[model samples]
Target: MMQLENLQPYAIVEDGPFLRIIFDHSYISLLVDEKSYQFIPAESSEIFINKELNKVHNLFDVFTFEKGEEILHVTVIDLMHMKQFRTQLQQIIHTFYEKRTMIPVAEVETIVQELEKENILRLIDRAIDEGEEHSFLELTNRLSEYGGKVEE
Candidate 1:
C-alpha cells in the first residue's frame, strides 16, 4: 500500500495539442483516486518514432471531455529531452508544495479558510457512499438517532 506520501506530486501541463508529463524518475501512472490511466502516444510521434522504437506504431492516445470516463495509462518519455524543455512534473509538484511552506502566516490562513469551504463537498461524498447501501427511512432514522437533521 502506498500513501500519497509514497508518490511524488506532479502538475500536468499542456502546450498546444500536446500533453507532456514529467516525473521524478521515469515512473508515472495517471489516475483519479482509484482509477489508473495509460499513455496514448501521439499519432505523428508514433509514426515518426516507429523506425527508432517498435512499440508505438498504431496505438491511439485517448482524449475526451467526459467525467468518470477518462483514460488512464503509463507514459514513457525521454527524460533528457523533457528535462531540457521543462522540469519533471513530480519535481514541479514538490516545488509547489515546497513553496507553500514558505508562505507567510496570512497567506496560510487564507488557504486554510478556502479549504474549509471544501469540507461540505467531502460530507456530500460521504453521504453518497453510505446512502447507496441504506434505505432512506433507515438512514434518516439513524441520523436522527445520532442527533443529526436529515432531509430528503
Candidate 2:
C-alpha cells in the first residue's frame, strides 16, 4: 500500500503491540485484543498467513499469491524477508517534473559565413538562442555558400 503512491524510507517494528505502519503523518495499523505487531513495508494477509502457517508445518492445501496461485510449504524466513525487503531497496523516485530541456549547441560559424545579409553575426546569435533544430539547420544551409573571406 505504501508503494501505491509514495514510498517510505524507514519503518518501525513492534514486538507485542498492534501491527501498524506510519508514513509521513498517517498511521495504518491493526489492533486486536489490545495486542498488535507491525511489520515494516507492510505485506498482505496472504503473506502473513504463509508466514504463520509455515512456522508450524508446510501447508499442503493452502492457497498462495506469490506466483498467482496457491502453493504449499512457505518458509518462515522467506516470509520475514519478503515482508521487509524495502530496507534493502533503494527508495529514490523520479516523479514527473517540468525541467528546462537542453538543446544541442553547435558552433555554426561555417553556415554564418554563407549568409549575404550584413548582420551575419546577429543572425548566428539568433539561431543559437532560438533552440530550434530546423531553424539552425536552414540558416546554416543558406549561409554555407558565402564562406566570407576575411580581409588580411
Candidate 3:
C-alpha cells in the first residue's frame, strides 16, 4: 500500500517507445509488453529516487499490484493524491516566483562597496603621480577603511 502524503506531483507523458512519469526532479519510464510491465529509470533518477524515497522497493510502486494480475493499475487513491500533490507544487512554485522578484539588497551593497574601493585606488594612484601628499594620504586612509591593501 502506498501512502498518499508522501506522493509528489507527476505527469505521465509518452516518450518515443515508452511512457514516462515525470516528477519535479526525477522521472521513471515504463515499457509494457504483452503480459508484463517493465519500469526503468535513468542512472541519475534511480539515485534520486533511492535517496529521496528510501521506502520505495521498486519504481512501479506508483501503481497498485493485485494478486493474479500481470499488469499494474492506477487506483482512485493514486489520482486523488496526484491532484493534491499538484496543488501543493503550484503553491510552492508561486512562492518561489514571488521571492525571486524581490530586490537583492545585500548583493547590490557589496557591488557598490567594491566599485567605491576601485575608484578610491585610482584616485590614490593619480595623487601619487601628481605629487599631492595630502590627497594621497587621505585616499590611502579611506582605502584602509575598506580593508583594501595598496600593493607596492
Candidate 4:
C-alpha cells in the first residue's frame, strides 16, 4: 500500500459562510456551528472522499482517501480544536510536574524510621559511656525492633 506523510495544508480561505481547506488535489468545505458541523468535499469527484468525510465523528478528524493501492490521509482541524488541544496538553504537563515533585508517603516514613534508628544508636552509646543500665537496655530493645543488633 502506498502512503503519503507530512501533507502540508495549501491554504485556508473563507468562501461565504463556509471555510475551505485546500490541499494539492482536493479541498474540503466546512460549515461550522456550535452544535454540529457540515463537511462538503469539493474540487474532486472521488466518492472515497465523501465516504471518508461521512466517517468523521468530530469536527477535528482524519480523512483517508484510497485510489487503487495508493492511499492518502488528510487531517482536518479547526482553530478552536487546536486551542482546546493546547490547553489539554498544558494541563497534562502541569499534572506530570506536580506528581514528580511530590514525595511518596512510604518513602517519607522509611526516612523517618532510619533517622529514629540512628538516634537510638547514639543514645545507646551515650548510655554505655555513662554506665546507665536501664537506658542501655531500653535503647537496645528499640534497636532490635529496627533489625539492628547492639553488642552486649
Candidate 5:
C-alpha cells in the first residue's frame, strides 16, 4: 500500500483519454470520472441512496481503492467548481511538461490564487443574477479582501 504521509495537493493530468489526479509522487493517482463524482453538503449528513440491499450509496461510492477510505468531503457546488479549475490547471501543467521547461513552484501558487479569484467573482456574479442579497454581500466582502474590484 502507498503511504499517504507525503501526499501533496491534487493536480490534474491527462492519462490518455481520462483525466487523473496525482497526489505527489509517492501516492497512487486518482482518476477523475465526473459521472461518478458526488458532492455532499456539510449541513445535511444524509446522502441520497437507492435501496438495493439495505445499503446507502453515493456517486463517489462507485470508485474504490485497495487501501484508501474517504479522503475528502466537499459541497456539491465546490466540487463542480473544482472540476472546472482542474481542467484549466491541467492545460498549464501539460504545457510546461511538454515544453520540457521548468515552472517555478511559486508560479503554480500564483495561478491557483488567480483561479480562486476568478471563481469567487463568478460566484458573486451568480448571486447578483439570482437576486440573493445576503450571498452577494457576503461574497463581495470576501472578494474585496483579496483585492478584487467589485462593480456596483
Candidate 6:
C-alpha cells in the first residue's frame, strides 16, 4: 500500500556494467554488458544495507523482451519490487495522460497539423498501455530530456 507520494523517486546508478535504479533499500539493477537485469526488492519501510535481502517467499522472473538478435534479461526480483515498480510506472503514465500535460503544446499541435505523421503519438500511447515500468520511465525520461515535459 505504497503511494508515489510516500515512496522516494528512483535513482539510476552506474556500477561498472550495471545500471542500478535505487530507492532507499530497494533497487532494480540493469546489467549493460549482458543486457540483463537483477532486482532486489525492499525488505520493508525499515532500511537495510544488504542489497540481496529477500523478504518474499519465492524468487520470480518476468521475461520482458526478445528479438532475433536483441535480448534483455531481468533476474531475481521479489514481489514487493514488482508492486512498487508498477506503481511508479503508473504515476509516470498519469503524467503523460491524453490531457497532454507533459508533451509540449507546440508538439501536440504539430502532430495534429500533419495529415500523415505515422502517428508516433499513438505508438507512445500504446507503449504506455503495454510497456513495462522500467522501459516506460526510460523512454519518458529520454523524451523529456529531448523536448517533452516529463516530470523530473
The C-alpha lDDT values of all candidates are 0.38, 0.33, 0.51, 0.50, 0.48, 0.41
Candidate 6: stretches off by over 4 Å: 1-6, 10-20, 25-101, 116-152
What lDDT score goes with residue 54 in model 6? 15
TM-score of each: 0.19, 0.20, 0.35, 0.37, 0.34, 0.23
lDDT of 2 by residue, 107-133 (tens): 355444434544654566587788776
Candidate 1 achieves a global lDDT of 0.38
RMSD of each: 19.5, 17.1, 12.2, 16.3, 20.4, 22.9
TM-score of 4: 0.37
What lDDT tens digits, residue by residue, belong to model 4 across residues 1-152?
Answer: 22222233344343343334344443322222222222223323221112223221234455544444544444543322454433433443345447657999999999999999999999999999999999999999989999988766
The RMSD (Cα, Å) of candidate 1 is 19.5
Clashing pairs in 6: none
Clashing pairs in 4: none
lDDT of candidate 6 at residue 109, scale 0 to 100? 80
The residue pairs that clash in candidate 2, if any, are: 17-36, 18-36, 18-37, 19-37, 19-38, 64-70, 114-143, 114-146, 115-143
**Better by TM-score, candidate 4 or 3:** 4
Q: What local lDDT does model 3 show for residue 136?
A: 92
The residue-by-residue lDDT of candidate 3 on 20-139, one tens digit each, is 334543222222342333222222121112223322223343443322445356533343355554455445444544665677989889999999999999999999999999999999
Clashing residue pairs in all predictions, respectively, total: 8, 9, 0, 0, 0, 0
Off-target runs (Cα >4 Å) in candidate 5 are 1-101
Tens-digit lDDT string for candidate 6 (7-51): 342543334433233344223334344443333342322221122
Task: At residue 149, give the lDDT of candidate 6.
Answer: 46
